[model samples]
Target: MNLFADIRLAVIAALDALVAEGGLPAGLDYANVAVEPPRDALHGDMATNAAMVLAKPAGAKPRDIAEALAAKLGADARIMAAEVAGPGFLNLRLAPGVWADVVRAALKAGAGYGRSSLGKGVKVNVEYVSANPTGPMHVGHTRGAVFGDALASLLDFAGYEVTREYYINDGGAQVNVLARSAYERYREANGLEPEIREGLYPGDYLIPVGEALKAKYGESLLGQPEEVWLADLREFATEAMMGMIREDLALLNVKMDVYSSEKALYGTGKIEAALKRLEDLGLIYEGVLEPPKGKLPEDWEEREQTLFRSSQFGDDVDRPVKKSDGSWTYFAPDIAYHFDKVERGFDQLIDVFGADHGGYVKRMKAAVAALSENRVPLDIKLIQLVKLFKNGEPFKMSKRAGTFVTLRDVVEQAGADVTRFHMLTRKNDAPLDFDFDKVLEQSKDNPVFYVQYAHARVASVLRKAAEAGVDVSDAALGAADLSLNTHPAELELARKIAEWPRHVEIAARANEPHRIAFFLYEIASDLHALWNRGNEEPALRFVQDDAAITSAKIAQARACAVVISAGLGILGVTPAEEMR
Candidate 1:
């Protein structure tokens, strides 16, 4: 029931008819032809660029082709009028019955109304929030978590087989630092004043991990050397940190389908195998990298290293896989991890990283390209920072996290639904300001509140109709005679509802879940505008004196609610039946 898509097909069919009638030459590629909502709603319900796109290709004037295409499209019963606008743009006004059918379709489908098959069930692995297994997730990781989870849900709605994954950074030197920090805490738990060192993690979240360590290893590890206890404590502490991270994610209602370990690639043949695949293609070699372009580091030296020829595959330079010290660089395990992803047979891969990792994008894509021989596509989305404010002032750091705000702190204050919705209010690459006071305020300025209020208002309408003895079930509403919904306000809301499936496809194709939030806000604005109009004209009220009229109006409101619920479901936010 995508009216926009249906109209595009009609326009294409009309162009084909023109070719058949010998009015236009054959083979005028129609791929660029599009039927979309008019820029100005007052102009028409939909607009098409078939004439403008085909004019030059067909060796015809724009207006001439537009007039011919308009005449051909006017024959369709769904299109009430097709008027040529500026320079060959065809604006279309759809029949009222067409809008009525869109409402009926929404009511019939309920939560499944806007689901799309854009991906055709292609397997996509979405790796996100792969923060170091050292401490609780911070505000930065929270944004990535929300964005990734919503993206996974959006892909699922768009018919992609999505796997939500987290890659644990346990093999890095950071985890060894975590081990030393936890050992100090273990000594603290054993009634000794622990050394609060500078390099070790200082968060109180790991104090429990230290206590747990004492419970497991007891005082036997208290006086041992680093070798005797470091490895065991590193494994134990990482597991505890991961457990805490899982709980933090749960607080925001985020869950992962897989958890990959960086440590698992160490001492395994996976890294060697991934590099071997690149080496076989003559992409791996030992060479000296040129000095960096900008200000060179004080200790900068042009030393020979094992490098991957990433420059051939779009990276700025060949990236090193191993350092001069004969140890794997950070890029080595990453290449192996992505190679593992490609080997798992996923058709596509998506990684959600913080904006600081922007420089790593090209190199990572190059690695995946080399590993999959360009067969698998990798899309990396970098989420920017989130600045928090309380009462218009900068929010303070979390005491539990020691220096930064924890995900749990934000969730506990703003709630999971509000936090998730607000996090997506801005584009992923754009910095976001999370104002605690503004987000929770129950005003139209707040998008989350406005959208939720729309759903709640619809529920109120249904309840009032039901109490008045009007049948308000979806089956009844969908079957209602909606011809009475001829008011401009009512019709406009239906127009917005018809755009749901089209918007879903657009957002999913761009891999931008933030678009869904914007769409929801627009639809909610329309719904609120219509609801407020009813106060000025009692006849426009949903619960009319006549049962048939009330049923029709209720049906329209229910359809809007249906789309809102579906959009919220994709965002992992529960729709409110009644806002408290």
Candidate 2:
């Protein structure tokens, strides 16, 4: 129900009354007026700058405006007090019934309690996990995958039509490396000692790809030269690697809506079409770029190359699309791919890149700006590194991914739900530490367990109530006389439940999914605190001696569980029904 928005609307209506009664100017701009939580909750539930923002424009003192505004707002049924504080801030405290209504609203709305219409169904494309199809996904790519998937879900919850996409980097030297790597596996399948060359992939994961090639070809590609079997084996090996990647994502419950291959764009005139559109707009030209700031490449030479006028769109300098040798640089297909996305009529595009790709953000944004004619906006989120630990020691590397820890290794150790939730516990641009020991710990220090433990605790209460012959269905709980829950601890939880819808909008507007994680943690903390409180005072417990009073209080606690479950659902984490 967005209680904050409801209160803000009431405040605005009172201000409108002030203008109508001739106490204020005729058409004062109220856009700057805001109703939000007080800096210190000790002040009140919400505070607004209605007085100060209007004081300068109205040629009146802030106290005069605040005093006049307070009298009008004091009459609203929901507002218990509208006291003017420091300068012109209007601090408000809503009645206990207001918080009580929030609990009822949560039970009625269920998991869809915080779903918003902020995006209004705008089309958005999210590109993530664009790793080369050379091997299994590693820890770095895992963060990107989890971040992007959670972002897409968050946007969808905020009423955006989100499309999860993956760009396959098969149109480069990496795929050729995959081909050569598979060629050795092919020989290995032929009962010969395969040479694990210095540059070739040395992972044992390709052993199965070797075995699969033998079954498919059956001596057809035996003893073949590089040119003879390169193309066939490259396609096969790439598919096998992608299959493994899909399985890895499936473990974390991440599913992509689309998978775009860079190789599919080559030789199809798509690159020419996209670049020609830019050229016609005077964005593409043949030029020589100044050498990068400090150390230059050993073979750095000034040569004319095809370039994009990225500087016009806010990049540091014009970027090269084609190298001096007339071959397409790595950015050529990227431009075409983004252009394709722009042509698909998406209102916005978002790219989740690793922190190492920070340098490419500006140029990529510039390309989208030029290609979309400044109509579409692009947001590139750079996910910082993840450091893994076990019992406070660094986790060892995986032999499958050949170097770093693979996503499968982490999932195998911590399980998919723990891995996903722990990965998202930090901001996308901040470093995250995934400690196997800490995550699996069943204490309040572990957020994943704490949140799940809250849900499971609620389940235990419901089961106990059912065994005692009490009807604990959501309909019954929502319909219970929750006015009996007048304890301060119970009221505080109800107030927190009221903040969910507003928090959803704030989190969606900032594009920060971590805020959702933080909110869920706070909700769990409040619930757990109340649970602990009951241990001291038996009267505050869920199952009281009186069945009717028990239903009233248990309903309030169950409502809190409903909101937590919904929030965790948006984050793609499974709420524990019972802690093991």
Candidate 3:
């Protein structure tokens, strides 16, 4: 039901016929040949580069090949006209029946209309929102959470077996700091003055964790030394923090399929095994790294360490796996985690990180490459910062988080659906300004509202049609004589509907879920434009005098709504049945 893909295939078939007839040279690669919408819709419904792409390879002139291809394509019933423009591009005008069929296909497919099998069910692990088990997720993690969740849904729509994962940073020194901070809170629960140290987590969110520890250990851990209580408190506080993080993610409708712990890889021989694999490949060595190019750290010195030859796999330099102090560097556990993923037999891996982690990208990818022996591909997406504003002014920080706005604050203000949709209005690497005033505004300026309003409008039409005794069920609409939808405005909206399948494939292939939001906005614009046009031309209205005509028009509107709902689903936003 993908009109564009079908037309591209037809173009390819025509080229193969040319080769068979000896009109073009044999064995010309047609991979680059494409059929897409013409730049100017006035020119035609579709355009193809079959002639231009094959001209040099076929040892023929562009115009000569285009003329022949045009003649061949014009004979097809679906293509009403095939005119060569700009030397070799063939612009095609499809018959009205073709556009009608697009509407029918959409109604029959419903929300499944745009689903694609591009990934062929390949297992893909999408690790995102891997915030440390220290506190509730903040605004930065919210952006990554929404982006990664939407991407997983997008990949699922495109037929990838997606596993949403969260890599907990519990194995690091940060968790120990969290433990010490919680111990202070525990002392506070026991009527002691808690020392809020400068380097410790200062968020009041841990106050509850202290109460819980007191409930479990009574007064036993209150006066214990660091060595005696540190490990137990770290484990207890890490669990509490994760519970809070899970609650925060639930507020934003984010759920992870896997929660991997960095600490689990310790003493399990996993890190040693991952490094051993690299060592067997001659990628691991004991070496000294040159001092960083720019201003060096005050403690910087050339020291021998266990390093991975990351530069061999396109990193800036070799990366250390172990420090001079005989402890595992931060990168080592990450490598082991990825190695575990590779052993789990995923076909692809994607990591959504904060923009500040950009420097870690190349080295991480290099580690995966060396560990997987280039058998697997890893993609890391860096999500930029989100600037929150309220009433056109900068929003204040959350007192609970102490330093930043928590995810719950954004969700509570805007609601989950609005926040998710607006978060995806910009590319992951582009800064987004979330203005509470602007996003809730019921105007075209608000993409979320505009798109939802389009869906609600179609729902209203369907309800009115049903009340008017017009059979508007999907089966009836799909079988309606949609040739009645021949008006230019109606056909234009149908053309946009036909682009849905192709758009889904493109967005999924690019791993850019933002494109889905953009597509939804474009199609919503088209729906709104056509709806407005009906005001002046009563015949363009969905509820026409004739039942058949009304059914056909309603069918088209329903089709557009179907695609909108599907796209919204991919974005992790629920389509509005009616906007309140």
Model number with the top lDDT: 1
Across 221-301, the per-residue lDDT of candidate 3 in tens digits comes to 866789999999999999999999999999888889999999999999999999999999999889999999999899987
Compared with the true structure, the alpha-carbon lDDT of candidate 2 equals 0.91
* Model 3 regions lying over 4 Å from their true place: none
| Tens digit per residue, CA lDDT, model 2, 1-580 | 8888888888789888988998898889988888888889889888999999999989999999999999998899889999999888899988888877888888888888888889998999999999889999999999999888888889999999999999999999989989888878878998878888989999989999999998888777777778999988889999999999999899889999999999999999999999999999999998898998899889888999999999999999999999988899999999999999999999999999999999999999999999999999999999999999987799999977677799999999999889889888999999999999999999999999999999999999999999999999988888888888889888888888888888888888777888889998998999999999999999889999998889988888888888888788778888888999
* Selected candidate, larger TM-score, 2 vs 3: 3
RMSD (Å) of each candidate, 1 decimal: 1.0, 1.5, 1.1
lDDT of 3: 0.93
TM-score of 1: 0.99
Model 1 lDDT per residue over 251-331, tens place: 989999999999999998999999999999999999999999999999998899999999999999999999999999999
Error (Å) of candidate 1 at residue 93 is: 1.0
Ranking by TM-score: 1, 3, 2
Worst 10 residues of 3 by lDDT: 216-225
Candidate 1's C-alpha lDDT? 0.94
lDDT of all predictions:
0.94, 0.91, 0.93
Q: How many backbone clashes does candidate 3 have?
A: 0
- Which pairs of residues clash in candidate 1, taking residues 3 or more apart in a chain or in different chains? none
Off by over 4 Å in 2: 26-29
**Local lDDT at 6 for model 2:** 83
